[model samples]
Target: MLETDRLILRRFHKDDWQDLYEYLSDEAVVRYEPYGAFTEEECKQAAISRANQEFFWAICLKERGGEVDPIAQAAGKLIGNIYFQQQNPPDFMCWSLGYVLNPRYQGQGYATESCQAIMEHGFTKMHVRRIAAMCNPENTPSWRLLERLGLRREGHFIKHKFFKRDAKGNPLWTDTYLYAMLAEEWPVK
Candidate 1:
């Protein structure tokens, strides 16, 4: 588990389904994602599935100054999720990062904090050599976040991803920006 001053990044719990649904079910939150808004059942299953993953984490708000322990308090309110998948050939020491935040919590630096922690964990704890992330070109905030985190934009793939179906049910193809950072480039804390 990772803790920031006001947030805790921990493994997901089965009970976190409702919290996950709060954002996953919102179309706006999933707009740039390949998947559409999720049903409650899908959220529940996703929570269950994610709970067993080694790299997926639930981002929760830390409830300050309570009788309960900080971790317990922090676990109570889920605000987002993050994950990293190891690239092919585990020995390559490379991983792809992904994250989502509840729209209500955007513009607060939480995404940057959480992602920085993950990148550090990957580089130091996981002994990863490189970390990469990708976002739709239209997702300005996302690519900007990646840049702010020190991942250099490596490529822009035009019409590379069929993200979802449009209102008329036609495939919606979008461009993507790929970003990456080598461990040598990451400042060790």
Candidate 2:
């Protein structure tokens, strides 16, 4: 598990389905994502599935002070998740980073904090040589978050891919903005 000032980046647990459903069920939260809003059952399976995956980290708010109940403190709300997975051949030492956050937690620095921690872990502990991220050109918040994490805007692909289909079964192509950072470029913390 990784801890930031007010966040905890930990692995998902099957029982976290409720909190998982909280944000995943919101259409706005999944707007730019490949998948649409999730159903409760899908979230239940997702939490279980994510629990078995080593790359996904559940982002939780660190409960503060001594006024809260012990159980509540132990089980923080799962605001979202961070996906940091190693790319092809293990020899590549490259990884891809992605994230999804609840709109309620938007405008705060939790996303940046969790991502920074993951990047640090990847570089220092995982020995990752490079990390890359991609997002729709229209997702300004996503690309901006990438920049805040110090990743350089590397490329802009035109009509790169499509995640969803239209009512007529036509592909909805979208442009992508790629960002990357090398281990050597990471700031010493």
Candidate 3:
């Protein structure tokens, strides 16, 4: 598990289905995502699936008090998730980063904090040589967050892919902005 002053990044648990449903069910939250809002049952399966995947991290809020309690903090609300996965070819030493957060918990720096923690973990512990992220061109907030994390905007692909279909069941193609950072380019903090 990884800890920040206000957050904890740990493997997902099957019991976190309820918290997963809270955000995954919101259309606005999943707007830029590949899939549409998820049903409760989908969230349940998602939680279980995430629990079995090492790349997915459950971003939880750390309980605050006079003295931080690890046990209580571990039970804190599951506000979001971080997807940090190694790309193909083990010799490449590259990884991909992605994230989603509860709309209610946004506007604060939780997403930033959680992402930074994961990037730090990838760079220092996992020996990741490079990390990349992709976001829809229309997702300003998401790309902005990527910039805040110090990833350089590398490319812009036109009609890259489609996640959802149109009213007539046609593909809704969208542009994508690719962002990446090399280990040597990582800000020395």
Q: How many angstroms is residue 60 displaced in model 3 relative to the true structure, after the best TM-score fit?
A: 0.3
Every candidate's lDDT: 0.87, 0.90, 0.92
Tell me the TM-score of model 3: 0.95
TM-score of each: 0.91, 0.94, 0.95
Residue range with the least summed lDDT across 10 consecutive positions in model 3 = 63-72
Candidate 1 vs 3: which has more TM-score: 3
Which runs of model 1 end up more than 4 angstroms from their true locations? Answer: 64-71, 167-169
The TM-score ranking, best first, is 3, 2, 1
Candidate 2 residue-wise lDDT, 71-127, digit = tens = 654377788899999999989999999999988888988899999999999999989
Q: How far in Å is the alpha carbon of 57 misplaced in model 3?
A: 0.4
lDDT tens digits, residue span 1-189, model 1: 987877789989889999899899999889888788999999999999999997898888786333445456655578899988899999998999999998878899989999998888888898999999999988899999998899999999999979677789998888989999999998733
Q: After superposition, how far is residue 183 of candidate 2 from its true place, in Å?
A: 0.3
- Worst 10-residue lDDT window for candidate 1 reads 64-73
